[model samples]
Structure formats: structure tokens, C-alpha cells
Target: MNGDWLLRGRDGRLSVYQSSGDAVLCRVERAPGGPWDEPRKVGGEQRLLPVLAVGQGADRYAHLVAWRPTVQGEAGLVHSTHFRARLAALDWNPVGHPNKKGDRTGTPAVAVDAEGRAHVFVRNKGGGVSMLAQKEKGGWEPWQDIRGKGVQDGLAAVTGESGRVELYAAVPEGLLYWRQEEPGARPVLKESLKAPVRPGTLYALATSPASTTLYYTGTGGELWAWRPGGEPVALLPSAGHGPVAAVRCELDGHDCTLLAQRSASGRVAFAAYPTELESAGAWWTESGPQLTVDARVSLGTDEDGRVVAATLSPSTGTLLLTRRKDEPGLALEAWRAV
Candidate 1:
């Protein structure tokens, strides 16, 4: 449904609001895949930004992360939690809590592997990047510094078809990747790409399931793609002036498209490439009329191969949803009327 918004809490609480701003659904849980038992109010006077990720399963579970402010002027810390639909639970359990001093940590990006392990990537205020993982039997693992120093962007995780966990982070120097074959072992640096980087800047990265091609946008607004044996190919010709967000998904069962959003004017764009054209060395073609959208749009896909774009209205602070049409010309249909 377009315009309908879902808000999640740091403690793994979920509240679904109707298009008319009515609270229609709510739940709480200890973990995403869990037997949820507790329920409580999401206490806070200030607005909290909720980031959620669907786990790797046929019946996907939603994991949430958020940052809250403390009573003092200092910003509250980041927290991790999860929820699932089967149990109809909405309470969020804190996998990890923030430091008591409360110096302002940012929200975390979450991912769950095939084994149901949770991986969190967080950017500390001091410009350091750390990753935390939770094993099945073991509790929270010690936070590992992915980027020892410098600001990071475009952190993402995807469970490869081979069952290996792939993590990507874009730093000031370039893009960095890490992989782990099994638990209790360090994640090895699989690859790194040297490219122009900028601190406090955001870039989008996604790997094709079929080809494992890593795609990203530079600070200069140019789109680039990297494969195993091939050089990085520049997809977009002209550069723009703002951050880029992208999601990789199949289109019409034939084309693999990278749906990206430009910040300069809040326009949604698409870069469609034939999945069968993986080794053909074909260039990425861009197409879009640049629709007006809220600045905070999140890109995702549904089970039926439909692209879903969610954003919160800056003015009314309402959530909006839009879906890409299943037609042949790469059109988009706004399910939620702005």
C-alpha cells in the first residue's frame, strides 16, 4: 500500500499506520525469528528513525535498528532488535546497548545470514566503522573495526548463493569487501576497489545474485560496476551533485535493473541491464523522468519481483510507498498518492 508507513522501535516494536494516519497494526518481539513474549510502549518524545532489514528466509523476518537521545544533550546510542510475522510479535529486544555516556552513535544497518546470524554495521561519531555479529549459540560477538579510521558509506551485506556472507563498505579511499566461509573465523578481505571517495557522503552498492557484479556510485555521482576479472565500468555519463541510493532486482524476469534515486531533485532513476548480458561487456543504460519524492526513500523488492520504494514525507512525516510497473518500458506506479 502506498502512503502507509511502518515505524519500528529500537526494542523491536512495530507499528503500522494507515494512510489516514491511524495506527492499524502493532507488535513487539525479542528477536525477528522468535517466540515473542513481551510488549511495551516505545517511550520517547523525539522522533526516532527506524531502519529495518528482512532476513534470508521464505517467511522473512524484520530486524530493526535505531538511535535514541538521552535525557542529557548528548545523543543516545544505537540499538539492535528484530520482529517476525508468524508470531505476530512486535516487541524489539536489544542485541546490544549503547555506551552509558551517550555521545551520539548513528543507526545501524542490519543483515541476517543463512544461519540466522545477525550482522550489524554502524558508523560511530568519531568516523570509525564497526561491525558486530551474533551467532546462534553464542551471544553478541565483540565489535570488529571494519574501517579502523575515516568516514564510511554504503555498508551492505548479502548472503551469497554459495552460503558465504559478503559485506561491502565504501570508505574515503575506496570500496572494501569482506567475506567469511564459516563461523569463529575472521572475515577475509575478498576485494577492494580504488576510487574517489568522500567523507559524510553516501553511495549505493548492490551485488547481482546471478553475476555477483558489485555496483556503486561515486561521490561525483557517477555510477560504476565491478566484476571479478573486468575493470570497473562507468555506467552513468554525467555526474550529479547529491548522494545516490540503489537497489538491485530483476525486472520482467528478463532484465536485471539497478533502481537508483538521485538527491539533487529527488528523482527516481533506473539502470536496466540484461542478466543474460553478464559477460557481453554491455553498458548500463539509464532512464527516468525524475519523479518528485521525499528525501528519505528506501529501496527494496517484494516476493513477486516488484520494486518497492518507501520514503517518509519531510513535511507531514508520513511514509510513502511506490512500486515499479510490471510493463516492458520500465515505468513506475505510485501506489500512495502523494
Candidate 2:
């Protein structure tokens, strides 16, 4: 299963924490397209899947929410823990417990708004959404049970320009989207599209308050995108079998959405979707470099305007970083720390 394995730290460094045997191993890079440090054991004797969120302004620390699964006799329980640490610190101090029932459905999703308040969403044992927010001084508030049914595995969230936070999840019938206009506002159920989207990964792109794009994997392994008032568009057929990782980035002087996924054959591939969806022939026809091995691929932009794509080669147990070289258009240069 895929944990929230890749994270871009507050100080432009990239960190990847994955399950190595019975422990969680973490490795950090100096910056985007830079050298990486040695991998160190971080957590012990737990199947830990970590998701990260950074605090804003003066409270600048990396906040991590990880799910720890345990099996006792016939009942399986997943416990959730929150950890916070500075960018340069080696120790991850525990902050609070978000999951009280010790049963979680998927990876937790976090988004900090303009006022530095963090909103965390997780699928509870009742197959509904349970949410919590951060207080002004510190610590988290009590869990608020948002009413929903048949909520799927993955949860994706994005805060728009108007401080409107949106959440997306998959159901058996289609996709369910919820929106909270401001902090302390109730998350209203916006829409439920009756399409055959798989119940795993959902991506929400809030480029502006007026425009937003939602992408997900269809039942047939096709990459599909949906806008506010339009029909679902099949961007790429047979895109992949997993969740799509995307980032809104500037490419060649245009705002584009960069999506990366592992192909069916276990190779890392990426595509670009231009902002002008109605433009003529604007789809990404150019091919991305096909990496030989792939475990779980991720794409993100660093602080120094550099786009870094990483994939874990399961065979060699190497986390490969590919820095985009834009001298003669788009190209990739591989880097690995000794």
C-alpha cells in the first residue's frame, strides 16, 4: 500500500519516509536538485504512513500525521498520531492524538489556510468524514463528525484564494465534494457526481477562486478531469492504476498542471495539462522520461523554482531524484547522494 511517503519540507528540503522492514526510514535532501543525506531510522515497529503539513508564519514547523496499523487477534486497528519538528531538527516530537477510535480508513489530508489554522480530515471507522482544526494559541480542537456515507480511501484538499477550503472523496457511486467557505464554517456538501471513479485517490486544484479542476482515476484506469459546470473530460486513457499526483506550476511561461503516476508496467510517467482547457491542441503530447523502476512516484516544486520528480526503485531500494533541466526545453538530470 502507498503511504504519504514524499514530503517537501519548510526550508526547501525534500524528505521521504517509507517503511523499511519493521521501522520507518527517513532521508532528507538539502534542497531541490541537491544532494541527499543518509537514511536514518525514525520510527520503530509500526506500519507507519505519514502525511505532512507545515504551519504558517511564526509557527513554522513541519506537522506530520501518521497512521499506525496494528493487528490483534482478528480485529485490526489503525491509530493516528501527530508529530511536529523543525526543518533542521532530527527529533519528531509528538503533538496530539487525532484518531480516538484507533480505526482510520486512509491517509489523513491537511491544509493550512491564510490565518495559519490547520484543517485536518480523516475517514473514521463509520465510513464518514471526521474533521478537526487547530486553535489560535496551539493544540487541536475536538473532532467534528461531518455527516457522509460510504466515504472512500483517499482524501484530497485545497484552500482557494477566498479562504474557501474544499475536500474531495470517492464513493461507490461517484465523487463527493464538500466546501467550507471559511474557518468555523460548516462544510456543506457541494455536489455528488454519479460517475465510476475508483475509491482511492482524489486531486483538487484550486488555481483561483473562479476556476478549479478535480482529477481522479476512472474505473477503467483512465485519467479524467472535471470542472465546475462542465462534463467530465477524459484527459488520458489508460493513465495508470493509482492516485494521480499533481502540482500547479509555471511551465514555459504558462501555468500548467504537472501530473505524475506509475504506469501499468511500473514505470514513472508524467503529463502536463495547460490552463486553457478549451485551447486547440494544448494537451501534453510530449513524452516524459520513462524511469526503469517505480515504487510510488511523486512530483512537486521546490522553493527555488525547481521541479523535482522522485521515485522509489524497489529493486535497488534507491530513491531517485530527477531535476528538471530547462535549458533546451524540458529535460531531467538524475541526482543521488553518496
Candidate 3:
């Protein structure tokens, strides 16, 4: 019912979206740390769990998809709709078919490649994996079934440095990974990356254009991350079983991956993965628990990928900007590895 995701537009502006009953509310900013505009409602009451992606220049647009459950002829069914917002217009325009329905297997996920094409991933009613892609001119391709089996876990998408668009999902057994190497590229499924099955959701952080890290909660409120080249490692000694949110941006003059998750005590905890200048690995920092539980977390960055602002969710918290001068307090602090 509140905003849960943050994104930067091609025009160097930041936008936040949250569900408000049947409609989605959007708040925009000229830049990450500046004053935010008043929230505007978009789409209809049936629109829920909206996913977004931003494209380039004239191609700059916010692609959104949502699902609403309804009863038709005594059969309960979930229907989905897709929309796109032209950043310059600040309004959402319906695109694609309005009658799309899902098997309700999982929430939809979207990612835009460097070329400005939108790639959508969703699980169907029969547990089948499917993808719908946007065409170069301006239309969506028919849904292509990637796999026949459906999954109940949530889905996420990212565009890697190789320009390949990758999708990740959490299945009962382990984390599933798939990639579409290029536009029109077939979906290639990888072996399930093994992990313990306690904490509920999986969150992905693209530490760099080419690197991504997956984080999830473990038994006993521990936070763990699937490192790029290593096995899963414990991140926080005590984290909530709730979902995690993260972003890749610049921090303290370095490109870093910032992470947010709930602590065992229900307050949000912040962490950072500072890139190692000389090596392939990185240094991660764990901070003390503070802030609202399950707060919507987002990071904003400059062209070079330096993080300029971090907006913790609920639409009422402070915009943690890069310190103009050395600041006090750990919540707004950025740390470097010793």
C-alpha cells in the first residue's frame, strides 16, 4: 500500500512508486537528493505490484505491469496489464494487451537493456516460465514460454555488462537463474544455485554493470549473500526473515552496492559492498539496526555510478545524501574498508 521501489530516469531524475489500494502512487524528483514532487496516482484499482524499467533518451520511459484478481463466471482469475510512462510527459500510457492473465505463479519482473528494449518475465498458472519482449519500433512480442513448469517464488531482472539480460527467481529447492544473451536471444536456464531454504525471499544487487549479488535471510535471522565467485556468506549476524532491497551506486567516491534488510529486532539495517580496487572481490560492511521495519529502500547515483542519495521507504524518512561535509551519525554514514 506504500511505495516499495525507486528508479532513476534517463533525464537524470529519480522516481518512486508504491501501491495505494487499487492504484499506484508515483513521486518524482529532479534529482535524487532534491525536493520530491507530490505523489500522483496512476493506473486503475486492479493494478497491483507494479514493476518498472527506464530506457534511454527519447527512448526514456517507465514500463509498468500489474495484476488484479477478479471473479468471472464463478472462476477466480488474476489478470495483468502493462503500461509505459514517458518521463517527459509524467503520465502513464497503456501499451500492449490489457487482457493478459497469469496463472498467478509469481509477481512480474521487468528490465530494460542498454538498447532501450523492455524484457518482461513472469510465471504462468501452470508454473511455466514465460517472457514478453518489447520490439524496437514499439510493440510487444507474444509471450514465449521459456519452460513449462510454474514457480511460486518472486522474480527479478537485471542487465549485465555483457548487455545480456538476466532473470532470477526463487524456487522451492534453490535459486534459479536464466539469461537472454541478446535481443531475440533464447532463454538459457542455468542449474539451480544451491542455498539453504529458510528465509523467505531473494533480492538481487548488481554491484557493477557486470556483477550481481543475491542476498537472502537464513535461519536464526542471519543475512547471507551469494557472492559473485564464491559460496554464500553470512552478511549480518541477525537479520529479519523479510525481503531485502539493494542498489548499485557511487558511495564516498567509489562505486558501491548498498543493501537494506530488516534486523532480528524488526528495524532496518544498512550495509555496503565497496569494490576492491586491486582485486575481484569486495569489502562488505554491516551496520547496527535502525529505522523502520521493511522500509522501502533506494539508492541514487551520478553518471559515474557514485551514490548521491538513499531514500529509505514509507515516503516519510530522510533522503540520505552524500555528505556535503563530513557528517555525524552512522545511519547516514559511508564507511571505507580498513
Candidate 4:
């Protein structure tokens, strides 16, 4: 998948997961330095689609989910989480196959609540939403239907700043939202939000303890940010054509929001602005070697909580990594291939 290729373990080591052909390959960071272990096959063979990995809660267990074709009109969703410990890629667990024919099942998106339960949500065949949650006893509940018609295929989910799981689906009109009344509770659908969000470009990040921001590319190619109670703020001097990899970190002594996207020119474009201040402004700078526009960009923190971002070049099959330098601003060390 052109999403979430990087995962940070509890010990702050990172693993980069990618599907090379039908197998899932993983490369682990041996230590904090630039040296990395070679990529090894982690997942078995299947007619797989895009892969997604979500790390959540204090344990920060990363749950990897992938969809693969089975029989006619039937498909399977599989999951894998911490095996032995963090940075270990082991076995795959089944989430059952759904056999809804004709209108094929949509792609899967996943998030974990404060207690570290995986809640898998997808667009059902009828154009509405359905969800499955991981039980405390380590099994999945039967898929439950959450009503929201005309939902587009790509869905964005996040464990919100409040520790409640929230989901967003884009319809033709605007955004359909679902949020839990409390942590570990089922997310209830809220009234539709009005925006011209482009599909496959919607992602949410908790930029602060009190604020979670929604970022997306607009129908007119502009980038927009919206919070729960504010207008959709268009980012100035936008230059990307896809979703963004975002993080909140202290740049020197000031809090900043860092964003990275694959610019239209096929390079990793990045910038950082003061957190929650769009009008204050930031500019886009392209970095690294030229990669495809759909190349996945990911962000996480090192053992010391310094920011790190990475991307893989399909053309050369090399993992390109960068890190936040110990400077007064959001400066980065040179991009290196591993």
C-alpha cells in the first residue's frame, strides 16, 4: 500500500513494511544509527492488496492489516500484531472472509483505542460502513454495520487526541464522521461535515493534547486543514497531490507541526509550521532522490523522541531515511539510502 510503511516499536526501533509482489517484506533498524538490517519476507503469499500498520496506546503495538482475494466474490482480511516483542514480524491472524458479491467490499482501515484494541472499519458493498473490533479475549467480533451511505472506498481512521477512536469517510457531498462517546466505546456517527476532500487524501493526526487536525487535498488541488469546531483552512503555497505524513514535535523549544507529502514533481516534499497556526505560514521543500508520486511517506520518533521520516523507492528498491538534527529548528540530516 502507498500508506503507513513505517512503524515505531515501544523501544523506539522502527520497522519498514512493504509488499514486494505477494509477500510482505520487512527491514528492521538494528540501532539508532543509519545501519539497517536487510529486508526479509515477513508475510506469506496471497493475492494481497495494499498493506496498513497502526501503532497505538502506551504499548504502541503495531497492528498490520491486509486484504487478499480468496474465491469468487469472497475476500479475506488478515492481521498481525506484536510477536514476541516490538520490531518482531511473526505470524498472521485471520479476521475472517466476507463473501458479499456483486458490489465488492472496499479497502480496510484500522485504528486502536486507548486500551489497544484494533477496530477494523470498511465500506460494505451497499455503500455504507461496517466495522469489526478486537475483543479483549483476543478474537474479532462479527462485522457490525455502521450506517453512512455513499461512502467512498478510501477511509481514514485514528485514535483521537481524546483517546477515543474516530473515523471519517468521504462522500460526494462532504465528510461522514464517527467518534466514540468515550474511550473503548463504539464510535457513533456524527452529522456530515462539509468539505471538498479528495479521496485517498484524507488523514487525521492529534497535533496536540487538545486538538486533532484533519488534513486532505481539496477537489481543486488545494490542501486543507480542519478541526472539530473550525472552518477548513487552506494551506498556503501547497505543492502536493496526495495525502500527507504529519507529526507534532518540539522544534527547538517551540512546538511545531511537520508535514511531508509526495509533491507533484515526484519528490518527497516537506515543511513544518507552528502547531495549529495555518496563517502563520510555511513553505514546501523537496528532498531525497526522485520517487514515484505514490511512494509512501512515513513519520515517527526515535528512542529519544526525535522526529524521523522515511520512504522507499520502487525503482531502485532502496529504503531512504532521514532524521531530525539536534538543531534549533526542524532541520534534518542528509537523506541516506539503506
Candidate 5:
């Protein structure tokens, strides 16, 4: 995949590594010189979803919760906060200390709104899920319980054009969604999916810009999508394990969906979906060639809706990124060969 890759912080600054196998391609750093004032080491045993939020201007910030082994016994918790050069100048800060009762074994995911406020979600060891949100006026809010006795597998949060923040969590019971109209207001549960049962894995979620349509790949190797006032539809039934990476944007003035996945043979693959289709029966045209990378691939998108693919190089063990383009169809654009 062709995308920009930069060392997140100054050298030797402990950072969170989001890698493909052994290759650490993208590093997430906490904001330095803020309330913390020190570089926080972020890795030990728990995987971290380094949540990043970019403002309307050039400012950006990232927050992640990680666990470190206790000095004398088991594990301790810490939240790593990093502010981009632009966001640091804006004085965006990490809210409060890490939640002591948070799950020290699993990765914690977070979401940020347009105002630079953050909403953190994690699954605790006791099978309880909690949410920690930051308000615009500053200071940390108390942890709120969302569900009990189930895992919060993944979270996808988006701020709508109306300035409302919506959070969707993939829990064992089903897909749970919540929304908040303003700060200090409790998030109202909006919807839930109970059919076509899903297994407990981190499923990827994405939303269309023009509508409230949500898309995700279930644990059962099926591609599922749902929108407000619509029934859930299975898009691709045979698409296999791991969450599908998707990006939504307007193409030719019509909303489009770009999804990528790994084949059973470990090759990378991609498919495009048109918004006009109402059923999952539409055909998906393949775009890229079988990848040669050794590590599993993870994908994301830029603000402009370009697909960014990251994978670890098997030969040199370095992270590689490439962008996908289409002349009339999907094509591989520039690439950073590792």
C-alpha cells in the first residue's frame, strides 16, 4: 500500500508498535511535555489499539491503554498519551489516570470526536465493558458501564455532521450502538443486532459519510452491513476470518465502499461495493495481485479516502505500505518496498 510513514516521535521515545508480524511499521506515541511530561512505554503483553484523532486543522492526538507486569506480582495498567506537533501546540491533553480495574490482558480501544475529545472503551477481565469519555471543557469523566458478562470485541466511533458522536461496539450478545448529542449527556443506546450470531474477535467497523450505514465482517466469514431503518444484509458470505478493512467515500458523486481482506492462502485481496445496491448479492470484482509478504496485512484509510495497506516484509522483517488505485479498476499506486 502506498501511504506516508513517519517515525511518530523522537528517537528512543518508547512507542506503541502496530505491526505485521515482526515488522513494526507504524509507531504511536503519547503527547510529550503535556500533563504527563514524560515518554510513556506502552508495550508488555497486551495488544493496544492506538487511537488517533485529527482535528479540522493540522492537529492530531493519540491515546492507548497498555499493561505492564507488576513489580512483585502480576500486571499493572498504564495509559500512553501522545500529541502530534500540531495538537501539542493546541494544548490537547490526556484526561486522567488509567482505570485501575481495566483488563490488564486485552487491548484497549478508543475513539475521538471532531472537537478533540476522546471516548475510551475496554473489556475487563471480569467480562465487564466500560467506557471513559473526555469532555470539551477539560477533565476526565467517570467510567461508565455499557455491558456486563461479555467481551467488547471492537469499537467503531464516528461524529456525524450534526456534531453527534456515535459509538458502536461488537459484543458477544450482538452489535450494540450508542449515541450522544452533547458532552455530559449519557449516551443513549440506539440499536443492537441479535441475529446471525458473531464470535468473540476484534471485528472491523466503518461508516459511510453520507448515511449512518455501518459495515463489518462477522466472525463467521460473512460480510454484514446495516443502516438506519434498514434490515441487516449479508454482503459477502464466503469472506473468511479476521475483520474486513473498509473505507467509505464518495466516488463519482455516489457513496462507495472499499474493502480488503486476506485470502486463505495468505494472499491480500480487495473488493469494492456500490452504495446503490440494497442486497448482499452484488458481485465483488477483485483488484490486487496475490501479495508476497510474510506477515498478515492491516489496512486503514487517509482523510481523502485513499486505502493504505501495511504488512511486514518476510525477508527483511520491515513494515511496508502501498496505496491502491484504479485506472478504470483497482490498481496499485506508489509503494514503499521494504
Candidate 6:
């Protein structure tokens, strides 16, 4: 539930991740959706938390980052890559601990910049933030203390259309965040807004290169959207139980944002909105029958440019995916077992 569970690589193959037993398991496609290979324990004996897989660069290389418990509940984040083949077909490079003492950390979050360099952030043991950035050509830089106070984990990181990286975390004061003034520069705390936000439910939509709209679930599981200088817009009073899944796509010529959430009945409930124009109003739409299990939904664009929604079947721990119909709107095909 921490990292992105679904990603489509540049090579047209898809990968799905899950936290199975004592490891972070990954299953890659032989083709676009299935037939998928068996789940591989990519974290080795690391006792991983949920696996996070994201694609970066023109080649769309999939980077795997996960947290493993270390000394006295302190956690270390490990990094690895899947180049152009099956996941871990290349090498699993370990990024190890930020400090020799291995300070305790909240769940780590990552945002790959425009240049494809990953910027990693976490709520350090100090209740502040610390960051790890990748060098321009190779290697990772030292972990720098990006100070803050009363910050929570479930950090949300994303690169804006302007190529700047932004980080957000819930704090007692509302939301504490940082944004880079320009590309490749280290970000600093730029805004601590008076917004009510549920930590770990944040998902962002880059409306423009310089602007992004944040989507998250409220304390009562209602869906809300907000931007840096705008008031929070309530979209759905009931949007399931946890983190929302969102993606930006063009529909019927209009730029729209598509959202999916696990409904109260353990089914996938979704909706669409005019991107950045939430004042136009929106409506919640339920698709498919109620699922017996409460699993999270993840969205990704297919090789054909159709939005693909997937969830790990709780009963079988396998992937269940459905593709957007080739027509308009958010209509989707029936779920296909992978």
C-alpha cells in the first residue's frame, strides 16, 4: 500500500508489485498485461515493506525502492532497477542506509525528476525531513537533512511540469511541503498551508508545468482536491477507505483527471473530473460488481494509450486488470485475470 503497484515500461511490458509474506514480490509481463511470470522476491532476505515500482527516463526503466527494518525499528531504504527486461533482469543495487547509525524513518517516497534522476525523501527520526538525490551522471549524493517539525510520513513527491520536484507531508499545522524553485536544485520548505489532510492519502496531478492539484481522502473518507493557493474542493463524500488512485488523460478532447478508490463495500469506485477545473463540479461513478476482498486499485496507461486499472486479488494474490474501452469517457472492459 506504500508504493505504486502497477507500471508499464517503455518496452510495452507491465509489472505488478505486492508485499507478499516476508518479501516484496514482483511479477512482470511476457507481453502487455499477461501472461505474467511468477512473482519474484526481489528484496531477497531483506524483510521488505510494501514494494514501490516506478518508471523513469525515456527508456522508462523501473526503479524498485522498499524499506526494510533495521536496528531497533530503524528502517533502511534499498534501491534497484529493472532496465529493459523482466524485473531485476539487470542488477539489484542497494542504496543502503542514509546514516551509519541507521536512524528510524517513516515510509520513503520518491520522485524522478525531468532528467530521470530520482529524489528520495523520508521523515527522519527527528520528525523533520531528510533527502537523498541522484547525481547527474551516476551515483547518489549524501543524505542531506531537510529540516521540518511535526511532519508525518506517507510523504508525497512529484516532479512538476516545470521540472521542479515537490514534497508534501501532513503536519499538525496542516500540510508541510517543499518545492524546488528550478530544476536540479535542492528543494526547501516553501509552504506550510492551513489545510486539513489525511497523511498517506495524497496523490497529485500536474495540471501545468508549474501547478499541481493534490487529491486525497479526508478523515471521513470523503475525497477532496486542492492546490497550493486554492481552497480544498470536496469531490465525493464517500470515496472508499484509503489512498486514492489517479491519472491524467485526455477524454473526448478535454483534459480530464480519472480517479479510482476501494469503495466501502470492497469494490472499485471511480470518477472523472475536468482537470484543475473542479468548480465545474464532478460525480462519483461505480464500475464493476463489488469485489469480495478489500484491495487497492492502481491506474496506468497501456501501450495503446488506454488507462489500465489493476488490483491484486486478495483471495489469490494475483493481478486482476481491466482496460479502458477504446471509445470516450471512463468506460472500462471487464476485469481480466492475469
lDDT of each: 0.49, 0.61, 0.53, 0.75, 0.49, 0.74
Candidate 5: misplaced stretches above 4 Å? Answer: 1-59, 71-77, 85-99, 102-105, 161-163, 200-211, 218-220, 250-253, 276-305, 312-317, 334-338
Please give the lDDT score at residue 28 for candidate 1.
Answer: 31
Q: Candidate 1: deviation at residue 123, Å? A: 3.2
The lDDT ranking, best first, is 4, 6, 2, 3, 5, 1
TM-score of candidate 2 to 2 decimals:
0.79
lDDT of each residue in 74-132, candidate 5, tens digit only: 44434444454222222223333234532253445555666666666655666656667
Tens digit of lDDT per residue, candidate 4, span 185-303?
77889768888878878878877676678888888888888877667798854577668888878887788888998887878888889999989878898887778655778887877
Task: Check candidate 4 and list the clashing pairs.
Answer: none
Tell me how far candidate 2 lies from the true structure as C-alpha RMSD in angstroms. 4.3
lDDT of 2 by residue, 79-162 (tens): 222232123333343333334644445567766565666677777778888877767687666778776789887777666656
Top candidate, metric TM-score: 4
TM per prediction: 0.67, 0.79, 0.73, 0.92, 0.68, 0.90
Worst 10 residues of 4 by lDDT: 96-105
Which ranges in model 2 have alpha carbons more than 4 Å from their true place?
Answer: 1-7, 19-24, 41-61, 69-102, 276-294, 313-316, 334-338
Each prediction's total of clashing residue pairs, residues at least 3 apart in sequence or on different chains, is 10, 0, 12, 0, 11, 2
Clashes of 1: 10
Q: Model 6: runs farther than 4 Å from truth?
A: 43-58, 69-74, 85-91, 96-100, 292-294, 313-316
TM-score of 6: 0.90
The candidate with the higher TM-score, 2 or 4, is 4
Candidate 3 structure, TM-score to reference: 0.73
Per-residue error for 149 in candidate 1, Å, reads: 3.1
Better of 2 and 3 by lDDT: 2
